[model samples]
Target chain A: MSGAVPWNEARAQEIIDAHLGLEGPALPILHAIQEEFGYVPEAVVPQMAQSLNISRAEMHGVVTFYHDFRHAPAGRHVLKLCRAESCQSMGSEKIAKDFLERIKLEWGGTANDGSLTVEAVYCLGLCAHSPGALYDGEPIGRVDGEILDELASEAQKS
Target chain B: MTKIYVPRDMAALAVGAKRVLAAIEKEASARGETIQIIRNGSRGLLWLEPLVEVETPEGRIGYGNVKPSDVPSLFDAGFLKGGAHPLSIGKVEDHPYWAKQTRVTFERVGIIDPVNLDDYVAHGGGQGLAKAFEIGPAKVIEEVTKSGLRGRGGAGFPAGIKWKTVADAPADRRYVVTNADEGDSGTFADRMVMEGDPFVLIEGMTICGYAIGASKGFIYLRAEYPQCAEVLTEALEAARKAGWLGENVRGSGFAFDIELRIGAGAYVCGEETSLLESLEGHRGIVRAKPPLPAHVGFMGRPTVVNNVLTLATAPAILAKGGEFYASFGVGRSRGTMPLQIAGNVKYGGLYETPFGLTLGEIVNDIGGGTLTGRPVRAVQCGGPLGAYVPPSLFDTPFDYEAFQKHDSLIGHGGLVVFDDTVDMMQMARFGMEFCAIESCGKCTPCRIGSTRGVETIDKIVEGVDVEANIELLSDLCNTMKFGSLCALGGFAPYPVESALRHYPEDFRKATLPAAAE
Candidate 1:
């Protein structure tokens, strides 16, 4: 997770305005908003819809349809473990299960202390190095239980 | 100064190539050595990554799986001059893995500085666009048609036919969209092309624009590929600076530019219409075909929608002429397919070869069987939607028609091997579960049928009227197969049906313990 600042209407508007000239501005606007605040604030939905001249339902639908968009702020650090076939073949399920159990956190759950959030991803495109993960968007391959625990501790310390 | 090559490919970076590079830099400074470190792409020999190569007088010498701790010792062993070391695999091109590959699309992927336009030209990049100009748009399409190059995006539709459709469709403004939303597991050829050789794709898309009279293009890249996004962004800028993009490409009076759009993690967006919808910044729901994308696509204009591999191969087909590319493979499946070998295999990596090798050769010989050292039981050809092939069908040749004949597909050329310990019932259940998770939910058959399939499998797993549940599961699969709106629901039954047909014992075994209890 990035060091996302607190949401401000001025900042959100600036971000949205910068990308409004693009052919398909909705996704770019959403991505920029997420990048700035770490999550798309629900309050900005209507604001964006009005700005783009689209209906609120249409804007909300665009936001909710994609899996990448986050509804709430993530923890300081994020780890996405692969749940696809390639990773599954290399015992990624056991790795994920053990890590979640050790941390007492379910998939897509954030730590109470806001140290880290663990999420399930389909694939990280590191199939050749099976059982891959992305820790704050940095790819980690051949991931095992030990690696996950180490990453968790590292996140907490940082 | 000695030149050293380190892969900036996602797989290499994941396996600590950055750390190795840092260690190398630190060690070099300590030893007062002058060296040029070129961050190249992976050669696809992933089992040996981070595969460091030192350009020696003899050739580029390889050091396989080098850790930071080994960096000092590598220097001590005179690795710069291709000196003797335990990790040394000699000249990398001489390795059996590298020698056996028939790289056409990937010819320059691991060989060039990805973003460097001059390096791209040196490695035969711009020649395709030059040839396209020489032969004219009609002849360009003719060459592509004659090459027998089908869409490597699993559809296996002729690329020439689709290009021709977009070309013939009369419109004031046409669009060319490259589907880079590679959502398939056990596959990364598209990512490799984007990250390793972005210029090739740019050139390929440029040729398509010239042939189809489309000045504007968009690449719908998946958001999972953050690194590819960065690489392609830089590559696109480099292209524009060099007049390869922008108004009047390469001094030709044609205006073309490519915009990179990030997909919001939708697997169905890999489908053409869904991709266009996503590009238009909407919910990536599939559109009904007939007004086909070629006829009304990308803002209701004529469009050429092609996969990453299909577009990447265009430059080569145009440069060498169609017949040269057509001579490689057997039957209709001409040219090389970059078979992404992954999963529980010992030597897992990308192997680009002509379509004809048996599954047995790929899984056993090329892959060196299972990494677990267990007997191979099954191999999942294509993505999650693909069928599970038992060891009995290992002799089947890896081609579109041949695999289709066996009720399986050579979809996207992804081979995910499994050891004997794999539970077919579990895999079958996962098939439905994945579909249920990824289905666009526009059609009831996919949205509802997938959920029903999962429950039916679970019922059979729990041994609750096992025989009846099995029959019900098969019947549900048939409904989903024929009744669904798109391939999502249509092909979702493949894995479920294949597992039930071949590995009947595993399904029965799941019920046995529950029945005894």
Candidate 2:
């Protein structure tokens, strides 16, 4: 059930065979599956387990442990907000509070509207300047309460 | 043929990297000098920003902080073949400022072309990863433990112990997550390494994948580092194409892969557990420990969460041998740390040095004192969440144990200098305010305590219930530190207390005007 690639049996075997007999190879297998199918499907778990001679629970555990590894489908747009000390110094806390309230979602919580999913990020090294936010992985500088509202509204559109 | 590196960091650009690049292109064409113009990153010698290099009779000759207008004069001084220019700081090795630094982790960061794989190989870049891969998993874990590398991402947990947990987990499922969520203030070391020598990160990650038996890795990169993210993506692709990141790297048949997961602006996510939750497509809040990420992390599998800088240093450690890496630092804290010097400083830049230097030396000598050329009133080592170090503590040596003795922790090694003009009142409010904003509101201490602290500080500054408010603010800070779940709440008062202690006058009411705490 991975995006366009379609996680059929043959591709699953290729991913399994790819990481054979290597030094601790869970991450490598995960990377291939993620690449082949935008997300790791349940079906591929058994294949991976069979291929690695491990249990499906083991594969599931590995898949779930990484925040970056997605088992289910993800939306097109991913927005991240700064929660570091510098950004927080510039009133990012208030900005985030109001923005989340407006969107009615917590940090890292995806919108039911399906337009965007917002998450929290730590220092991005833009600290001398603060109250930063990112839209679709693009870091925008000079964020304030009003600016956050505007940005969230923009994300709502996409 | 003479060789030189043109640094491409922002500080270098501000001084004259762009103009120097153009000049080099023009002059190299006109003179037919086979000058290799590699746009490398900074060597962390900031005052020497826009620094140019010349492969000379002696090693690479560096011109400190070159200006575009001064370029012609440098070339005229017979600098083409590394002749001595007036601005030349001599051979890079001889410079006392650079020579003093223990640049093990940052050895090839600013020197090599970030995208050039061959360059990465020539400088012994992937040697550590190669060695690590050759040694197998158990040996890699043992090597990490032997080196005594702690989490550079604030926690300072043993990297070996973390790996061993994952290695020994009963479930066959496992993961290696690189925490690129570097949200501390005054920290640019992560960004610098990401931009300067991206391949090192890739190689480092590959080594992690190999050791943990992890087949896939994810760098939860912050969105603010768009340039870094872009370059990293390109590097991953290049690595994959060359079979370095993809299946069967180095013909070892050890399949490994890496990807970038962009972060939303959330500071709490810098915490490993929060990062895992965020990566799992949920809110970036901290999970209660006991389970720890090693046992019930990510998707409830054994997992290893490491900092970008920490992981990036792995390949180097493996390549050089554990003993060599362990020998650099002071005592229990081993290896070099990248200390970022920022704010009101003449030479505000990043300096990589071994543990155990004094705060005074770093702020005054290496940074060349304050940027305004005035007496430095306060120095904030280790980011905003870190303590406000006073001149009295100037003799305090840098290292984990040393800082712990002084009632502070080195959180990401960012050193921000402030002149006497800084107000403790505003600074205190900032500390509370920062936590208030970034707090995931997972607990009461951070969520409400921060807001309460701000009001208390504001009242004291305004002269209303001044004595009572100070007592209340101090009391609140203690509770937060004691009661808060994460550093976001616990360490929030470091800057506040340090600020209040050093700059009491700034927080005094106009009516009382008492300067001493």
Candidate 3:
């Protein structure tokens, strides 16, 4: 688990206000809020709903529907392992299994020290160099267990 | 000062292009040599990246698979003067992979500075929009129709017909939306276009807007391509400043502008309706289509929704006249398709060719067969939803109709090869599993049937009533195919069915008696 920051209403309002005038601003607002705080704070949902003139249920639904928007803050580093067919053809499953075992974490699990979060992404569009991964938004291609271990160790150090 | 070119494409960056650039910069500074380093886009020859190029009197000299450490040696070997080295690949265009390609949409991708408007114009960018303005909207539509250009996205719907419908529709507020949500695993053509030559996309969209009388356009880009989004944003700004994209574009009094919208990770959103839904700030759920996007789309107005390639191909069609593009291809598929060759292949990259090459040619001659050095077992043409064609069917031509004859699709023209080491049963299971994971949960057949398909495949793999489970899986696939809302569920059966039909031996392994085993 990652450390949580207390929700700040003013910051949420600022994010909402910035995107309020745009056509269909709900997704952008949520994205901005997440970018700023690392996750969509629960308290900000109703504020967003009211600003967008939609129901709280609708706002929550929007946030929950997209896999990219997180309800909670991620660990220090997020490692997205591509689980799509291209990566699978290049032996991503074995790499994924070995990395999970080495880190003592399952898919979508955070490390015990909260230094790393592992998630399954459909594709990173790096199929030409398969077994792709994204470590903190930087794509790593032809990934192996050793590479995953190196990334994990670096995250721990950070 | 000598000019050096290195790609800033994500794939290039992935394989240490940044480090290569840094090394070159450091070496130059240390030697007190002034060399202009230009960050270009990948030439789609991914195996040779980070490929460095130098402009010479003999034309551009190329080096491939260069490393940061190789930079000092490269300098020592007089690479600045285009001297021969171990990594020297000569002229990049002379490479067989590049030479064979029919690069219409991607002509300017690796050659020009991506964000520079003047560079784009110099490389024959605004000619299409200019031609569209000269001939007017109806002629533009007629020319596109004459070109026989179909949607480069999966469906193969005729592009001109879709435009004509939107153009004919009476609406106060019409819109053009580009589906840049390239979620297919073996595809990166859209990403390359946006990052490498964004103005082409802009030009294409502007042409669409002009033809359809639409004032606003939006590119719904996937969130994974942050770099592409940045490049596009910068390009949009540059284009606006240069009077190519803003109000009164090209001083023709045709006001049109594009806004960039980002998608929050959903594979099904690649489907047009779901893309529209996501664009409207909602969950990317599939919508039933009696009222197609062409008739009624995007906030309940007549809108033209096209894939990135479909739109990007427009500039060429308008510039050279539609008949010129139509002349290149075979059968119903006109012009060239950008084929993304990947997975377990020796020479994996983008290969744009006319629609007549046999699969054998692509896999053996072009790709040089499997990277694992094993005999080729199967090749999955298109994306995850596409069929896994057996080696026996390698004679099938690389065209839409030819692929359809094999009960497969030429979706986004993505080809992922598999060596003999692959297990077809596991691959089938993965198809169901991927569908289950990414289904939008709108229709029951897709959301529920996919999960059931996985369970049935599991039973087959476990040898628990294997034959019975196979029948059940087949039945489930049929239900999903007919009953699902969109291609996400409808085409999910292609891979599963193809795998089972082609490689029955892999599936039968679990069913062998214990003693026989």
Which of the CAPRI classes, incorrect, acceptable, medium or high, describes model 2? incorrect
- What's the residue-level lDDT of B385 in candidate 2? 84
Cα lDDT tens digits, model 2, A1-158, are: 11347657897787778767544455556667766876778888777777767778876665654455666655446666766544543456678888789879887677786666777766556443344555654555456667666765676665
DockQ of each: 0.86, 0.11, 0.78
- Please, what are the lDDT tens digits per residue for candidate 3 over residues A1-158? 33445578998899899998777888889888888888898889899989988999998888988999988888989999998888888899999998899889999888878899999998877888898888888888889988999999999998
Per-residue lDDT of candidate 1, residues B1-517 (tens digit): 9999999999999999999999999999999999999888889999999999999888999999999999999999999899999999999999999999999999988778888889899999899999998889999999999999999989899999999999999999999999888878899999998989999999999999999999999999998999999999999999999899999999988899999998877788888888888888889899998899999999999999998999999999999989999998988889999999999999988899998999999999999999999999889998888999999999999999999999899988888888988888999999999999999998888999999989988888877788889999999999998888788888889999999999998878756765688
Give all candidate RMSDs, comma-separated: 1.1, 8.7, 1.4
Docking quality tier of model 1: high
TM-scores across all candidates?
A: 0.99, 0.77, 0.98
Which segments of candidate 1 are over 4 A away from where they belong? B513-517
Misplaced by over 4 Å in model 2 are: A1-158, B14-16, B26-34, B72-78, B83-86, B513-517
True contacts kept of each: 0.81, 0.19, 0.64
The lDDT per prediction is: 0.92, 0.76, 0.90
Name the candidate, 2 or 3, with the larger TM-score value.
3
Stretches > 4 Å off in candidate 3: A1-6, B514-517
Interface RMSD of the predictions, in order shown? 0.8, 7.1, 0.8
Candidate 3, DockQ to 2 decimals? 0.78
Cα misplacement distance, residue B478 of candidate 2 (Å): 1.9
